[model samples]
Target chain A: MQTIQTIIGYLYYAIAAVIGIVIVANFVRSRDVRKMLLYAIVLSPFVLRVLRVK
Target chain B: MADSKGNSLVIKIVVVALWLALIIPGGRQLAAHRNYEEAVVLGPGVTEVKKLSDWAPYVANTPNDCSIYVLDSGVPGGSMLVIGGTHPEEPAGVLSAVTIVENVVPTTGKIYVAVRANRSASTVTRPGDAYPQFFNINTDFGKRTFRMGDRWSNPLDSWPDPEVYVHYPSKQLLAYMDVRNLNRTWPGRPDGMITERTTRAFIDMIKAENIDIFVDNHEAELEYSVISTIVAHQAAADVAAMASMMLSAGEFNMGMEFSPTLLHGLSHREVGDHTDAYAFEIEVPEPFLDRVRGITDEALLLEGKDEFVMRAGQAGLLYEKIDENGWNIHERVGRTNSTIDMIVQMFAMFYPDKPITYESLPMRNDIVANGLGHYLLDPAQAEADRVVYE
Candidate 1:
């Protein structure tokens, strides 16, 4: 059960990471950056996870 | 003036006035919590004081930034960190940290104490549950009052918990409200919410200071299976085993358990997994936390007695022992202080070069006999520079 839960947990983070990448990409493609800061806040947890800070 | 239209307009004004009168007083009382601060007197052993922002810039100017009281003995030795008020509802942890800062004098190593790790959480109370806004302890100087707090950080500071709170890195699903629970947000993110940022600041401080052992103080409900035990990481098993054994044999009865490998976001789990520092979480019983508790007021919080909880114990539902004597706040705080001392003592046996040594701290027996208020120093007598407000 622990292994199964871990697998699902990883999947969840992966999906979140994909969403975060898309947000950054949208900011880069669009030149309008008013909401970029809020978008960055949404991506922080996932980015920190990938960097192994958490 | 006596026309129907005039009468209707007058009635409307009177209704609005009544509504404002009813709402303004209650709103003012709740808002006053933000201004409430508990004074902490610097003990003789304290060498320096730093804010959480000194380590993490992201937490600067935020409500979660907390005071880190450092008691250095000059002689080089090991270091230990003690954090309190991770869940502000657990008053024992907060009181224990304050007692350490106000009385303890280390002789060999250094100690870092944070009286309220989640300062934002301490600014709100569960008034819906009939919790008192503040609790007072009778001291030699006068009554020392402390703000009663909730388990989660105030929504004002960290608003809008996620619908399905996911643990960072692990992504483990948790209760939505737990997003603000400092205890469940260990080793957090630099750009995360306020509670997470507070934890991230703490992790940076721990690694930068080269902390040997990290201790997180907490109080658990009597019904919780983990009560009266020291939850240690795998790396600290040997130290925890000896400490618990030594304490149980002569002093208070204590047990040790290893952190569950799968439990994410817990200090005992994440701190150990993320850093070289061994993590240990101490749990003392607080009857006021029990689901079957009575009154749910300041008296029940301090006295730790409730007929409902006793009844639950009688039915063989509680994991810890209970009786008419009841576990009071003094006993809870003393247990935390003594347990940390025991852990440091056992750690010294294994690593003498980095021995963590401290003296003049109130032990379980001392607090039980003298009461928790005996150790609280008078804020007025304290030098302005030596005092910090939580």
Candidate 2:
């Protein structure tokens, strides 16, 4: 169970990083800070899971 | 566009900050649980202290490793081992062992105590039970807090229980969760799970110390038939019976029963079978442990009072007696201590050559007069070298 939980946790982080990367790229090219920033908000759970302080 | 951009960045930062708010507090709580320590003030009787790893190397650096306080008399006599925390939910056992460690002054033989027999189990509370994170005892210095732990070994230390936990040698099927129940893992295998290894380590220490008597302290729910009883291995039957009679005559209504030969993986049965020591396990009534308990809080744990439990008792569903006064922690711990004193005396009587005598530990009335906290020494007042943490 712990192993499975760890795997799922890492998966969450992976998806969050992907979303964060796409948002950063769009923000750099289109300079549409609003859209990119809203998308970046989705990355909070991923970053927190990665940190695993909880 | 500028307003939209400002809103988006503000929202993103707010979301992240919100998560950070929750994460930091939650993380601190988890860390606090893991880092919580109970201080032990060395009693006037303590002559030496040894780590569990000194006997069994497998648990050397592990969280399961614990202290073994030796109260030696210098006078030649047999040694005895008293263990607590086998089931951390039973606070009486832990408190009784601590009282013995902090108050007993051996006059004949040595008395070895392992207050946190399963140290790893002490680090976690029962998640769904809503039990308090800690319970405090009022002392002269202030309040001394102790972690309220669960019955099973912490999953952080041992996880992913088998679908069917087959007892190693007996091969009897038990609940998968029993794999982590220290009481269910006995005469433990050296290479088995962490809990097993922890018990096995104690066995090694028991043998090396040439202990004559082995005691395991515990508290049972009033609903259980085993409550208020002294369970003895076949070898220690006489001593336990005598001890039970002695206690009942003056102290409390403690019964004596022999450990069933068919029962496997228990301290009384396994410790006696696996070692030369005469094994005995004592149980006191703890109303809070009953299924019908109400308000499972620190008050319930300490006072052992629950209207629901009393109701069950009135209905003839409880094996032990219960009333409005209830069975408080002081009563439970006092009973355990007096029982231990009786067992030691009886064991000494039968085997004069290996007498283990100790003095100054409180009994029932004394504990009632001055709560469990009175016997607990203040770490602040103790010498720096005499203070240890569990």
Candidate 3:
């Protein structure tokens, strides 16, 4: 059960990574300043999580 | 077209800079709080300090493997276990346990105090709620700081909360986040989540050590009906009722209630049902937790004063009364300490054979007078070996 929990935890990180990648891709290609600002705001959590800061 | 491209590039740079500006300090503060450790000075009463993993190995190498300070008088009587930090947001609960660890000397039987019963919960604060990462109490020596934690275990420790929490053994469905709540995971299973495993570890210790009385300390918002009360399991109802009566009649206003039979996960219910020990939970008022609270800062957390909460009281929407004085930390901790002292006395009175007695615990009047910090010993003055970090 512990092992399963650990696996699920990693799965969550993987999901977050995928979401981060999608957000980054959109952030890079989008030309709208407002949308870019929104993407950056949304992407901050992913950045922090990746850095293991929070 | 060139101007448009340059403008887009500038906007992107600004966006990136803004992201950095936000995450840099925010992330650093969170990280610092996560890693911060509070110091505990082992008083003369502390005979030995054992890890929770000593009783239950499932919690070994985990964040919830908290310290259990054993204060044994060596006299044959009864044993009691008092645990705090079950809901880490309740500072009074944690401080009350710390007071016990640093002051109380057992005269009969034994006393086991866990200042951080759910150590994993203490590692994080509620960012959405704007909870402070730490709070300091002005001690005689200087200041003693402690982590201001949340109600649930850190997501880093227990990740991917289920959509709905199905409590083990009882199969009662609860809110998803309660799976990480220590109070909601009583008599917990070893193979469960970190909080569940933490409670299970404590239960194992209780059984191993033959604890006769079990006390779980907590503080509730004025909006919560359980404030300034003792919720006792049926097994402990008599002692709790007597203690409440004595306290209300003499020291202060303290009510008593029985733990609902249907409440499957609560300490007052599960601990009594699962173990031989009588279980009781004490709750004091905390204005900081009120939905009608004002500024969410360390001052409100410790001072427990909020005009909004007082206004709520004026509207008669609160179970406990709040005034300009509010429910300060010293009062809350003092109330908790006094309640525990009353419970001990009542337990001893009821069961003469299993008597648990202790001395030097600052009572309600003493704490309300001199302040909570007066009881806290200075680690700097203590020997190097006498201090322990929680």
Please tell me which predicted candidate would have the highest DockQ against the true structure.
3
Candidate 3 lDDT over B1-390, as tens digits, reads 999989889999999998888888888899888888788999879999989999999999998888889999999899999999999999999999999999988889999999999888898888888899999999888899999999999888998999999998899999999999998998899998898898888888989998999999999988988879999999999999999999999989999999999978899999999899999999999999998788999999999889998999999999999899878899999999999999999998999999888789998899999999999999889998888888
Model 3 complex DockQ against the native: 0.77
- Cα shift from native, residue B229, model 3 (Å): 0.8
lDDT of candidate 1 vs native?
Answer: 0.84
* Residue pairs with clashing backbones, model 2: none
Which regions of candidate 3 are displaced past 4 Å?
Answer: B1-6
Q: What TM-score, over all chains together, does every model reach?
A: 0.86, 0.86, 0.97
lDDT string, candidate 2, B1-390, tens digits: 899777766765665566568667866775687678788889999999899999999888878899999999998998999999998889999999888888989998888999999888888876467778788888767888887888888766665466788876688788898888888888777777778888889889989999899999999998899989999999999999999988888878999989999988888988999999999999999887898898899999999888999999889999999999999999999999889889988988999989777789888788988998999999998999998899
| Residue A40 lDDT (model 1) | 47
For TM-score, the strongest prediction is: 3
Q: Given candidate 2, what's the lDDT at residue B153?
A: 84
Per-residue error (Å), model 1, residue B313: 0.6
> Which of the two, 2 or 3, has more lDDT?
3
